[model samples]
Target: MKGVMASVQDVGAPREKLQALEKIEQDIAAALSSAASALQELSKDKPAQKHVDSHSTAFIKTLQEVENGLSQQISYLSQVTTSQPHEGSSYGSQKDMHMAMHRSAHVKSRLSELEKLKMEHLMQKHTGILRSYSASNDSQQPLTPHTPQQPHTPQPHQQPQQQQQQQKQTREQQAQL
Candidate 1:
């Protein structure tokens, strides 16, 4: 009779352990389902993130480069203005030559102003983007990174010696010309 009672007690102990394990498994399943639903919500917004990233590239850089190109063109025009052609081109009157010179100067000045404004615009945009990314870094968002680092790093500051050397070279080239 005592043996039978001991056997029944052992069976009940195993049954209780099984029930506890089953409850744990159910709880884990519920947690996983909740996590999965949140992931689905995040996935819905991915396309919009893609759009912003597409626009976010050195986009301002390309714009700045264009402005630089325009500035170079403006500089060329200035050079042309400063250096008069040795040979004369036919002109009807002193007034006509004056008008043509005035027109060229006006165009050069306008372009310089436009290029300056464009450079400012590009700079403002670049700074704004930098601030936004710095803020994003502070936000501590999930690791779903939208941007990948490029192989080439962009540096804003030029070395003083390099700049001086470049200036020297430019002066030499101009002197030679």
Candidate 2:
């Protein structure tokens, strides 16, 4: 009788240990899943950062190019405007003078347009950079706990008395705790 009792106790102890191990595994899995979800949420910001960086670099390069073009255009316009038409020279025909004047005016208009465009581009780029900085700062904030709050739903067949009883029981349990 004593040997048979000992064998049963040994079997029950192993079963209880196995149950505890299973519960621990379940808890670990839940923690890992939550961590993975948080990582995925944070990863979404990387592409946006890359996009902003690329645009900033491109904008600076393009603006430099526009400035260079504007300078060249200004020099060309000055050269056209300052040249004296030779007196009694065939190259200084009335038509040639008219054409030179028209070219100078066109160049000046283009230079004005380029300046305006550069200003607009600078404003837009500055705005974008500021927005990106704000967004980056926001993204750096720590993630909040992701536990989903579920709304309580009563069963269709449950009576009002049953609901009241359930609520009472819950309150009593909480009071005990």
Candidate 3:
């Protein structure tokens, strides 16, 4: 009779263990269901996220276009200033010309700085986009901005004072004639 009771107890132990495991499985299923529903809810707003991304991309593109236009204009102006013929024999006029040349140089430097800033902004924006895209794609690819090789535009050098004076004298003699 004691052996029969021991056998019964052993069977009950296994039954209890099975019940506990079944309960654990049910709980896990319930949690998964809850998570799935939450994901579905969040997915409903994905269109809004996409719309914002598109708008941001468009804005960046427009800004880039504007920067490019300004850069071209600056390049053209720098070229025109450099190509201008020298003038004036008077010390005062020479001083004014010197100041103008300095100012032109300053402008070129400022424009170059602006271009650098614009490029940096563009790179940052692209990096952000790449990060977000890679996150969505589950990719491990690194983001790198494509920096194009820009031909160095030679800066305008100041003309010699003697050459400026000679041009000025020639202009004066022609005017007198």
The numbered model that scores best in TM-score is 3
**How well does each candidate superpose onto the true structure, as a TM-score?**
0.29, 0.26, 0.29
Q: Write the per-residue lDDT of candidate 3 for residues 1-177, one digit (tens) a residue.
A: 565334323333445535544554554555455445545545674545555455455545545544544444344344346654322114456778999999999999999999999999976776665555446643343433222233222234734654454344334333332
Clashing pairs in 1: none
Query: Candidate 2 — worst ten consecutive residues by lDDT sum?
Result: 142-151
Ordered from best to worst TM-score, the candidate numbers read: 3, 1, 2
The CA lDDT of each predicted structure is 0.48, 0.51, 0.50
lDDT string, candidate 2, 87-175, tens digits: 22243476688999999999999999999999999667655544544455433433221111432345779888766654543443333
Highest-lDDT candidate: 2
- Model 1 agreement with the true structure over 24-120: per-residue lDDT tens digits: 4554555455445445545674545544444433344444444544444344344345663312223335657899999999999999999999999
Candidate 1 C-alpha error for residue 35, in Å: 99
Which regions of candidate 3 are displaced past 4 Å? Answer: 1-89, 139-177
Which 10 residues in a row give candidate 3 its minimum summed lDDT?
145-154
